[model samples]
Target chain A: MFLQSDTPVQLVSSQSSSVLGEETIVLQYEAGMYYELNEMGGFIWSLLQASKGMTVGQIRQKLLDEFEVDAVVCQQELTQFLDDLLREKLIEATAPAP
Target chain B: GASPKKVYKTPRLKTLGSVK
Candidate 1:
């Protein structure tokens, strides 16, 4: 099901997203400003950018298809990564319904 | 701040603080 969060996290596609090595990246937009994301961040960001939108489960699925990691491991890692992105304001994730 | 290059072309990789 689609979610609706006031501060839902989504990438700014109009902005230039570039990969810099394995775990480094630069997102440039809104007046030459750049945001640097590390490797894990880049991976998550890459999926988001490619699909435009993916749920927590979808992200985990992608990880499963790409890497040889287990589902539980991927889920935990993806969930944590999503949480960090939200906490850091990197992404706008709607809070669970009260 | 010194000054912008007369002709801006090269990308300046300045160290960014922990904003992200």
Candidate 2:
């Protein structure tokens, strides 16, 4: 399923991350995997780290305020970016309780 | 003031080599 606005997400605690210049490097300890994120991806990583389980929509709104992009386009890109993170197990997403 | 559309470049994510 695609990540929706309300999907709550956070960085995996078992992982370690460091930033060098514009790139962010994340190491998943248990899996022994390394994932590198570019400048914009770094920005998104910071946002999620700052607020645990922040919804996808909230993240998009923050990005819209900081960057100039159409809402639709921003959402689309964010969805794909988050999906990649999920695939790598770098972040976890869950639905808010009803 | 005219605001220019921000050029959004897709962020690159790569394996960048890995360790077992």
TM-score per candidate = 0.58, 0.89
Q: Could you tell me which 10 consecutive residues in candidate 1 chain A have the lowest summed lDDT?
A: A1-10
TM-scores, chain B, all models: 0.20, 0.21
Interface RMSD of each: 15.2, 2.1
The residue pairs found clashing in candidate 1 are A8-A92, A9-A91, A9-A92, A9-A93, A23-A39
What DockQ, between 0 and 1, does each candidate earn?
0.02, 0.56
* Candidate No. with top TM-score: 2
Error in Å for residue A52 of model 1: 2.5
Candidate 1, superposed: residue stretches over 4 Å from native? A1-9, A12-16, A26-36, A94-98, B1-16
Candidate 2 accuracy as lDDT: 0.85
Looking at model 2, residue A62 earns an lDDT score of 84
CAPRI-style docking class of model 1 based on DockQ: incorrect
